[model samples]
Target: MMISNTPPPPYYAVIFTSVRTNDNEGYAETDALMSELALQQDGFLGMEHASSEIGITISYWRDVESIKHWKDNLDHQKAQIKGQKTWYSQYKVRIAKVERDYDFLKK
Candidate 1:
């Protein structure tokens, strides 16, 4: 997804940044599945993603508890293991609470 249609501020964002290994076997399918599964999670607001050599995905959440739940999800945990073993060379995750937000769109 591009810009995430999120709720008002004071929510949380989990920023996942990764650099892929040369091998991408099953990466696309796994990534798609993860996105779909994330949407099914409780308190999941939305997500934005982009990739080149480096990949970045930011998922919005209602609270820290929600974020923690996503992390501990069984399928997601499997994906994380797969990513570490096959897909990603390096990765980082950051969680932050949004205090305020504003956007301008041209119609």
Candidate 2:
């Protein structure tokens, strides 16, 4: 389920930052499939970001296992390759735990 509210402390968040390559092949279709995969996963909290040539997306998970599962997923695996080969020139993935979080929202 989508939760706009803050997540509990001790959660895991994967920050995927990428710089896209000039060559884009089947990008739209693959991107859509990745979104679909995220929606189908139980641990997916939500993502917040802005994407273009450079992008950052933070995907929340229940634990490391969930994150690993997504990494090993066939479709995602393929997408990762496509990213390296075509979509992204370089990318960085960081997995971290939320020991503390602070946020202020305007309503």
Report lDDT (CA) for all predictions: 0.93, 0.80
List model 1 lDDT by residue over 3-89, tens digit each: 888899999999999999998789899989999999999999999988887889999999999999999999999999999999888
Q: Which stretches of candidate 1 lie over 4 Å from their true place?
A: none
lDDT tens per residue, model 2, 65-99 = 98888898898998888788888878999999978
Model 2 alpha-carbon drift over 4 Å, by segment: 1-6
Clash count, candidate 1: 0
- Root-mean-square deviation of each candidate, in angstroms? 0.8, 2.5
Clashes of each: 0, 0
Q: After superposition, how far is residue 39 of candidate 1 from its true place, in Å?
A: 0.4
